[model samples]
Structure formats: structure tokens, C-alpha cells
Target: MNIPCPYCQHPITPGATTCPGCGTSLLREATPQSAEPTCGYHPRRLSLAICDRCGTFACAECLRLNSRQEVVCQRCHALEQDTPLPWDLREELGTFTAWWKTVVAVMFHPDTFPTFRPEGSAGESLLFAVLCAVPTSIVGGLSYMGFLSFVPYLLSSGNPSRDSVPSWLGPAMFVAIMILGPLLSAAYTVIQAGLDHLVLKMGGVTRGFQVTLRANAFSQAPWLLGAVPCIGPYVAPVWGLVARVFAYRGLHRTSWGVALAGCLVTPLLSCCLCGGIYLSLIRTLGGFN
Candidate 1:
């Protein structure tokens, strides 16, 4: 009689103990020769295997694969999919730490992309990018404020009156930076993500715009690196670019080549276009002079 191994679902001879396919200990006892059990869902059909989750008899039609690759009923499968990823636990874990772990995981483990559903609002994604920009902006702003406050003192030649900066200017700059930094960052993030989505469409990405936004948002997690004094500004952009490539590939379910083209082409084109405009403007002004 044909018997399937519980571990790997490989067909094996009846009365076998250890599964040759997966080497898992088949602690399963043989089914008794008594009356055949009916499926929990369809009473007319005979049960082939028991649902590992609910302990109910399941026919082949009712069998579904769980996260552990074990056989489960359709209800269990639906429930499992309905459960949230760690990234969605901001309410329980606090906003910064939750997104932080998600970012770290995405940067380190691109293969786990399948576990994330890439389902969130573009507005939500923009807000996330804005929040991620906060620490970086604060660090940079504080540095700028420090320079403004101290430059006059250091350059005074022991006289504070010469080239003195207004006391209110330093605090004013800090307040302005704190207020406008996140707003500007969020605006730029949204615009750039929209542009990236257009490029992604050109690359045959079929996922909706929301998914694209999510990928873009999560990829900007490296922006947190800008909190560092010297290298933060330099490293964050490069790190973000690399992360975006993987994020696009995973979220769009597209090839690496497509993801690369989508993520890089729009930004490169925009840079070239802006550079050309700047050069043209410079030449025009030089001619006028």
C-alpha cells in the first residue's frame, strides 16, 4: 500500500519508521483497518492526512501548506496569512524600534522579502521616510548651529564683538531645521518614489503604486546613518541605493536587472538633466557678462 512520508510528502512503503526523503522521525502510528474516517470539510470524501494544526481529518482538497511546510486545513492557512509581520508591530514595539528592526532585517536579509506583503499606503510610506529623516536632520542641524554659534568666537582674534552672530539666530535656525527638515524630506521621498514607480513600470513591474511606495520607504532606512558626524551624509545615500535595489526586486517580484534599471535610471536621468540645465544657465550668464 502506498504511504506518504509526513515530513517531505514523499511516497514510501507502508510500515516505514524513518523517512528516507527527509530523515525525519516518523512517529506517526499506522492507521487502523477500522472504518475509514471522513474529511472534516467534505463528509463524503475520505481523509488522507490529519491537519497538523487543528487535529481534524483533511482530504487532499482541504490540504494546505503552512509556514512550517506542514499540512494544514484551509482555515489555518488563511489565519496564518492574516497575521502581521514584525514591521507592522509599531503600536506594540514603539515606532522607531519597530521600523529599525525592519530596516536592519531588510538591509541584512533580502531573502526575507517574501515574508513581507508590501502592502501599505503611499502616505504612510511617506510618513515613514519623513520619520527616518528626523535623526539625520537633527544631527546635521545641530552641527550647523554649533558652527554658526562658534565660528565668530573662534575667528574673533580674542575679540567677541568682531563678526559676532546674533544669539537668537542659532536657536532660530535650530527651530527652523527641526520643523522643515522632516517636511522637506517627506516631500522629496514622495516625489522620488513616484518617479521610481514610473521607471519601475517601464521595467515591467506589475505591483501597484502602494507596493512601490512601501519598497521605497523601507529602503530609506539607511538614512538613519546620517546621524553620524563625518561619514553619515556620505554613507546614507550609497546604503539607501543598494537597499532600494533589493527592495524593488523583492516587492515587485521582478528580476534583479529590472529592479536595478528601475531604481537607478530615473535618478541618473534627473541628475544629467539638472546638470545640463545648470551648465546652460552658466554659459548664458557668462555670455551676458
Candidate 2:
């Protein structure tokens, strides 16, 4: 994003201290021994604003609006851009709306991720993953519950052993599916993201694990489709994987190849391992026969 130079109205690039068109100095010198506060970094310069992150006096040259649109000192801004995700502004946007907007952005406007700060807490990302898991988990649980209820009717028509299905089983399954499923999905999201981060590290990512975790969580935006009954569950994972590639690349400011490796390597390896194990099991069983 560009900001206008107050003097010439020239659009200045982000983090620039000098105006190109006007050749004007953005920083102003504080009068000697004046009551006005001087910049923290430059004692001779007057403060234009206080840094939001460090709460220190900052001159125009030392201040920049971060991705969150908060004015912070260049030093603090460099450390935490706090790229504004709608989900992070839940207090203002409200929870569900923030989540929906973030999902839409992740699914449709993935290019926007480059503007997002790669810094976020694991707790925040996990909460997002859990929210993304909710619709599918609830739908799956309800579907299972319905199937369980239907099973008794189907078995009763031709069998006398139908009473073998316990009465408490349906409710227990419902609780487990509805309550535990989303939580498990969130846990899996964290684990999968951690594995992806390891791949990113191999590919030369310098950012912390939280960056990968947040990317993974945001990529789960496609999982909202899991509310659509049977096909939703199948579609979500595939769509999410595609989104994950974009998320990793955009957030990490990495090459597309590195992003793809980070998102795909672990999953591909898992699939290959599982396939090999299955083939081995089948061969062993055939030999026994």
C-alpha cells in the first residue's frame, strides 16, 4: 500500500522515509530544549506520533503504518507487521462474520495473503482451524446418528438379533462425533502444519512455525463446504490442499516450488507409505490363503 506525501501529494511506497517527487524530508528536527517530545531513535527529531507497539516517540521518518494500519516505529513494525486478518479483528467484526470473511478471503482472494503478516499465535490459528472443522464435524455426526437410527429398522425386518445393538450406543456415538471430531480435526491441523513447517524449514523458510500453522488453518477455508452432506467431506480436503499451496507461498514470501513442497511433501509421503503398507498386507494375506 502507498501513502501520500503531505507536501507534494506524491504517493510514497510503504516504509519509505523520503518523498521522491518533492525531495522533502519527512522527518522534522525538534527545537533545542523544547518541551516537545523527540523521537526515540533520533533525539534531534520531533515526534510525529507514538509507536503503537513499543509506545515510544517516533518521527515521521521512523513511523510506518503496518499491515494492521496501526502506526508503529520502524523497529517494531519490522518485528511484527501484525498483518490484519479479519479473524484477528473479531472484537470489531464479530466472531462469525470475521470467520466468514476470512474464509472467503482464503478461498477466493488468496493473493491477499502476501499482505498478511506471517506472525500469529498458535492458539489463534487453532481456533480458526476448529471453526473451519465445525460444520463438517456436525454434519458427519448427524449423518452417523441418522444411519445408526436407520440401522435398527433395516435389521429388524429380516433378523431377530437386532436387539444386539445397544440403546446407549447411538447417543454416545453422537457425542463423540459432534464434540470430539472437530477438536480432533483441530489437533490434526496443528500436527499437519508442524510437519509442513518442517518441510518449509528444509526448503529454507526462516519464519517461525506459527506462520505455517496460520497458513494451514486459513487454507481449511474450503472445509466449510463439508456442510454439504456426503460429497462435501471428499471435496474439502482436495480443495484445502490447493489452498494450502497458495497460503504457504503467499504468507511465507517464498518461491512457488518451496510452497508446494511444504504443503505437498508430507501428504504425498503418507499416501505412498499407506499404499505400500496396504499392498504388503494384501500379499501376506494371499500367501496365508
Tens digits of per-residue lDDT for model 2, 126-234: 8899999888777777778778877887888888778867666777788898789778988899899989999999999888898999999999999999898678879
Residue pairs of candidate 2 with colliding backbone atoms? 83-117
- Per-residue lDDT over 97-163 for candidate 1, one digit per residue giving the tens place of the 0 to 100 score: 7777887886687666655766776776787788788898787678778888887788686885754
Which stretches in model 2 have alpha-carbon errors above 4 Å?
1-83, 159-162
Maximum-lDDT candidate: 2
Model 1 TM-score on a 0 to 1 scale: 0.69
Please give the clash total of every predicted structure, in order. 0, 1
Q: Would you give me the overall lDDT of model 2? A: 0.85
Q: Model 2 misses residue 260 by how many Å? A: 0.5
